[model samples]
Target: MILYTPLANTDIFPADNAVFTKRHCVSYQNKQFFVEETDKGDFQVLQLLSTDPQDFLRQEFNPGTIIKEH
Candidate 1:
């Protein structure tokens, strides 16, 4: 899946066999982030997986997140 967050200008492409479960977490730039798959075949960055200090602030891309087509 190609998931993008405009606020962060970040794109995440999961592998073909990448399994996305409620417990799945992605580590980007040393910070962990959660993933949630929507009913429409899009994914959501649920929230920051860690509560510790990080270089960047975590942005929430709730309902209006966009899916990019390749």
Candidate 2:
């Protein structure tokens, strides 16, 4: 089944302990994910995926196959 997630241009969590950003995103089975927003929110939202200190970030490898990271 295909699922769609709604996103916003606002921060869902508070920033602390270091530089923080609010990303409007949705995950596909916690594997492949994507963040959506207007032009203004693109940098802050999409950039979070490939930002520095990449420990807390993830990637969506494909659009099929039991939702596993390639």
Report the Cα lDDT for candidate 2.
Answer: 0.35
Error of 1 at 61 (Å): 8.0
What are the clashing pairs of model 1? none
Question: What is the TM-score (0 to 1) of candidate 2?
Answer: 0.17
In angstroms, the error of model 1 at 63 is: 9.0
User: Residue 15 of model 1: what lDDT?
Assistant: 50
**Candidate 1 off by > 4 Å:** 1-23, 38-43, 53-70
User: 47, model 2: CA deviation in Å?
Assistant: 5.0
Model 2 stretches astray by more than 4 angstroms: 1-22, 32-34, 39-70
Top of the candidates by TM-score = 1
| Candidate 2 C-alpha lDDT tens digits along 1-70 | 5445474324444346233333334554432234443334332223233234443433433222122223
- RMSD vs true structure, all candidates: 14.5, 15.1
* TM-score for each of the candidates: 0.34, 0.17
